[model samples]
Each structure stands twice: as C-alpha cells, then as structure tokens.
Target: MRIGELSRQTGTSTRSLRYYEQRGLITAHRDHNGYRRYDHDVIHVVKNLRRLLGAGLSIDDIHQFGTCVRALDLDATPCASALEVYEQRLRTLDTKIDTLNHLRANLAEHTKDLRQRLRAK
Candidate 1:
C-alpha cells in the first residue's frame, strides 16, 4: 500500500510515517513514479514502535531493543552499563508515579474544599 493508505489504516499521520522511515524504523519501496510503497508488515512495525516510544524509551534504546527483539533471545544478560540504564528508567518511572499520585491527592482535597465552601455559601 501507499503511505496514505498505511496512515489511514493505522490511524497514524503520513508525516509520522515519513519520520519513521527517515529514522530507519520503517522502510518503503519506490514504484515507477517514485511513490513510496509500504508493506503490510509496516503497520505492525509502526504499532510496535509507537508502543516502545510510549513506554518512554528513546530512539537509540528502541533501536537497540529492536535488535534483541529480532533475535528472539531475551535471556542474554546485558552489560553492566545497560543494566544501569534500565535502573535509571525504573527510577524515573517511580518518581513520575509519585508525582502524579501527589497531584491527584491535591486535586481531590481541593475539590472537597471547594464543595464545602459552595455548600456553606
């Protein structure tokens, strides 16, 4: 299919698809007219890439992970440095969760206070 069709089917924008292609996350073929042609597997690859990006992984990390993904070997112990990177990501997620929970608690308290004030008024 063409880029437009892939974008429409995947609910993704053509620009993003193009970016993915530029980033080497996706590939496309050229027809006689030089229009880019994408394979059906591109859709699944794009979805997986989106998932990894959503997980807060950087493009470099995604590329590295993609290698492992293709190898189908998850058991190989990574280097100490890689483990440190994973640990840092874990810590960042923990901090983000804590911040979000604090924000939720504050919002709940403010809502309760506002309701009480309205009732008193």
Candidate 2:
C-alpha cells in the first residue's frame, strides 16, 4: 500500500512512517511515479515498532536491532541492550506510580479538610 494507506491503517502519521524508514526500522520501494510502496508485512513490523516505542525505546535503540534483523542472509540475535532498556523503563514506571500514590493521598487529605471547612461554614 501507499504511505497514506499505511498511515491510516496504523494510526501513524506519514511523517512518522518516513522517519521509521530513515531510521532503518522499515523499508519501502519506490514506484515509477515516485510514490513509496510498502509490503503487507510492514503492518506487522510497524505494530512492533509502535509497541517498542510505547515501551520507552528510543529510535536509536530500535535502529540498533533493526538493521541486522532486516538483512535476510544474516541470523543475528536481538539486541542485548533491550533488556536493560526494559528494566530502566520498569524502574521509571515504578517511581511514577509511587509518586502518584503519594500525591493521591495528599489530595485525599486536602479534600477531607475542605469538606470539614465547608461543613463548619
């Protein structure tokens, strides 16, 4: 399909698709009319890329594992650094959760105080 179709299907912007191509995470062929044509398999790859991004991976991190994987003749393992990246993300998420819980408790206490003040008034 064309870039527009891929964008619509994947819920990604055309620019992001192009950026992925530039980052070596995906590829497309150029038609005679200069339009980029992507294969059906790209949908799966794009979804995986989206998952990796959602998991807090940078483009550089994805690129590190992507290029070698794309070369059909080679059978390289996935990037070992990904485990560290996932661990870091998990740690960050844990910190955020703790911070949010603390804030929620503070807010709940403030809300009770406000209720009591309103009742007194």
Candidate 3:
C-alpha cells in the first residue's frame, strides 16, 4: 500500500511516517512515480511505533529494540530487548522518586520550623 493508506490505517500522520523512515524505524520503497510504497506488514510496525512513543520511549529506544519492535502485536509477551529498556527506564524513574521524596521531607521539616518560629514570635 501507499503511505497515505498506511497512515489512514494506523491513524498516524504521513509526516510521522516519513520521519520514522528517516529515523530508520521503518522503510519504504519509492515507486516509478516517486510515491512511497510500504508493505502490508508495516501496519503492525506503525501501530507499535505509536504505542512505544505514547509510552515515553524515544526513537533511539525503539531502535535499540531492533527486531523486538517488529515482534510486538496482540500478544502480551514482550521480547527481551523490550524488557531491558523497560527495566532501565524503571530504574531511572525510581531514582527520580527517591530524590523527590528526599526533597519533600526537607521541605516539610523547613515548614515545621517556620511554624514553630511564628508561634514563638
């Protein structure tokens, strides 16, 4: 099918599809008329791209997924590469959470000190 058909089927913009091509997330062959033609398998790939992007995965992260990205479908199973990326992201989020909790505790103590000082005044 053509880029337009793929876009309509996946509900993704043609511009995004082009960008995905440029980023090496997908590929399309040019026809004699210079129109971009994609394979039927691309429909699933595009859907996975949108899902990964929505889940906060970067293009680089998707690239890291390699063939694993293409393997995504209705099946609830994610490939090992996908698992690695998610684990890394989880660790990063955990670090951020710990930092925020430390800051919150410090702010609470400061607020308590200010309240006690105001009462003394």
In candidate 1, list every pair of residues with a backbone clash.
none
Query: What would you estimate as the lDDT of candidate 2?
Result: 0.78
Computed on alpha carbons, the lDDT of every model, listed in order, comes to: 0.76, 0.78, 0.90
For candidate 2, lDDT tens digit of each residue in 1-121?
9999999998889999999999778899999999999998787678767777876777876665544334333223455555555677688889999999999999999999999999999
Candidate 3 lDDT, tens digit per residue, 1-121? 9999999999999999999999999999999999999999999999999998998888988888888778657257558888888888889889999999999999999999999999999
Instruction: Please give each candidate's TM-score.
Output: 0.59, 0.62, 0.81
Compute the lDDT for candidate 3.
0.90
Write the residue-wise lDDT of candidate 1 on 1-121 in tens digits. Answer: 9999999887888998999889888899999999999988777677766665777877776665554432223345344544554677889889999999999999999999999999999
Candidate that would win on lDDT: 3
**Most TM-score-accurate candidate:** 3
TM-score sort, best first = 3, 2, 1
- What root-mean-square deviation over C-alphas does model 2 reach? 4.6
Clashing pairs in 2: none
Stretches of model 3 off by over 4 angstroms after superposition: 72-78, 108-121
lDDT of 3 at 49: 91
